[model samples]
Target: MVCGLLRPDAGSVHVTGRPVSTAAGPAKQLIGFVPQDVALYPDLSVRENLRFFGRLYRLPRRRLERRVDEVLDLVDLASRADDRVESLSGGMRRRLNIGAGLVHSPTLLVLDEPTVGVDPQSRHAILESVTRFGEEGMAVLYTTHYMEEAERLCDRVGIIDRGRLIAEGGPRELVQLVAERDRVRLTAVGDLSAYAEACRRLPRVEGVARGGDRGDVVELVVKDARSLLPDLLDLAHQQAVGIRSVEIDEPDLEAVFLHLTGTALRE
Candidate 1:
């Protein structure tokens, strides 16, 4: 909707005082969109892909050439400028995806999960580029399910759940909003689903979700984690679930995220 590709169902979307749906050409020109999936020609070199996107914006030859080099360096893909999209690693391709968007030097860059499926190193690199973009006075609208990324990269966050804007605020502000809530993590075995549902009935426990690699972790958001530990242990025993360990203050933003949306904020 912000990109002017689709009309909003209600109200209006404006970009820099221009209506995105009505004045699409003018508004879209100021925006650069990077989707989650790779959207490049596998046969084309990194430089060629950037040049193609720049041309789509009708950028002048000289300006486009300079921006291409600048974007390559910006995304740390300058060394791989001649490498084809198919030859690049998952992380490298992710960086190039971002470079394609920056090729036009847009006023606002919209990144839709730019770090998805990338390596840890590449993810870190992409995050640094986002920081630099903001420092250089570019407006970046970054969308990610990870609250830690939002806390690190965004000055403002608007959490959308089930197509609704449930919360919007600064990272610290959002944290403080749910600060009173404590998180409990339990590593247990056997009948986890039944145990989770049983945990929900405990007083002052607001949210319950099963996590961990083997699905043996039970996470809960409660009014007071310290006081609720015994009840959780007792509930586990009653449910015939063996408790291996318990933890508190491990939930943070994710638990609050689950509490507000009634679903985990993950892909």
Candidate 2:
């Protein structure tokens, strides 16, 4: 709707002070969209792809050439500018995709899961580039199922579940809405269900569940996991649950997402 590709059924959509409709002339100029899939010609060089997009906005030859080079550098793809899209690594191609959206120097850059299938290194590069874009004052509408990404990158987030905006706030504010405690995860051998039940009875432990792939792990949400660890260990010993590993997780976007949606974000 913000792109004016699809009209809202009920309410209006706006971008950069312009109302979004089927014929959104000025609003379209201010918006840049980068979809999940690479929107580039595999047969074209990175520079060629960028030039192609720049020309779509009717950029002058001199300006388009300069913008293409600048965007290539912005995405850290300057060296790969002449390489064909098919010959580049997954990450490089993804970077080029982002570069294409930036050709017009848009006010609002919208990215949809830009790092979905890239290598860790490429993902890091893409994330860093995004951070810089925001730092430089670009209003980015980044959509991703990755909770950590939202937590780290967004100043404020509006969480949508089943097509509804269920929660909206800064990461810390959203997390505070659902949790006032840390979570302790214990991977152990034998009787995890019994251990979970026992853990639930402990003071300060608000919730407990048997989890993990083999059903050999116990998760506990507690007001203070460290302060309650000794009692947790003693009870595990009493229940004959041999502990293998322990992890303390602070509440984050994932917890908030689970709380509001009753399901994991990735699910």
Candidate 3:
């Protein structure tokens, strides 16, 4: 909608004070869209692909050449500029995908899961490039299902679930808005029902229930799981709950997502 591909059913979208409903408006020129899947020509060289996109924006030959080189360097694909898209590694191709959007240096860069299906090394590189974009004062609308990425990259996050804007705030603000607590999972050999019931009676534990397959684990939502660990362990020993392993999950964007959406983020 922000890119003006689909018209809004009601209301209006304005980019930099210009309405998006008008085709060929000033708003359209200020946007650089990066799709979820790669949209570059496999047969074309990296530099060629960037030039093609730059030409679509009607950039002058001299300016286009410089911009192509600049974006190639920006995405750290300058060394592979002459290589064909098909010949490049998955991460390098993803890098070029990002560079293609940057050819015209649009004021607003719209990235739709630009890091999907890339290696860890490439994902790290892509994230660094995105960080630099914010540092350089480029307005970015990054969309992703990865809660950690949103938490790390965005200054302000707007969580959309089932087509509704359920919440919007900085990471800390959003997490606090949900009022979720830490989760502790204990995998044990003994009966979990009695353990769960006993855990529920604990002062720090807000909720307790059976978790994991085979009903051998207990999940506890606590005010501060780490601080209450010693008491929890002592209680487990007293109750004859043979704990095999324990996991502490801190409250984060995932918890906030679950709170607002009534489901997991991936769901």
Candidate of highest lDDT? 1
Comparing 2 with 3 on TM-score, the higher-scoring candidate is 2
Clashing pairs in 2: none
Better of 1 and 3 by lDDT: 1
Residue 225 C-alpha lDDT in model 2: 76
Model with the higher TM-score, candidate 1 or 2: 1
Q: Write the per-residue lDDT of candidate 2 for residues 5-57, one digit (tens) a residue.
A: 78688898778668768783778888888989998999999999999988887
Report the C-alpha lDDT of model 1 over 49-146, residue by residue, as the tens digit: 99999998999999999999998888888999998899998888888888898888899999998887788899998899899899999999999988
The Cα error of candidate 1 at residue 195, in Å, is 0.6
Best by TM-score: 1
1-267 in candidate 3: lDDT tens per residue? 888888899889877898886477778888898989999999999999999999988899999999998998888888888989999987888888889989999989999998888899999998988999999999999999999999999999999988988889999998886454886778997767777788788886765666565767776667777889998899889888888999988777766775455343543
lDDT of model 3, residue 195: 74
Model 1 Cα shift for residue 11 (angstroms): 1.7
The TM-scores, one per candidate, come to 0.95, 0.82, 0.80
For model 3 the TM-score comes to 0.80
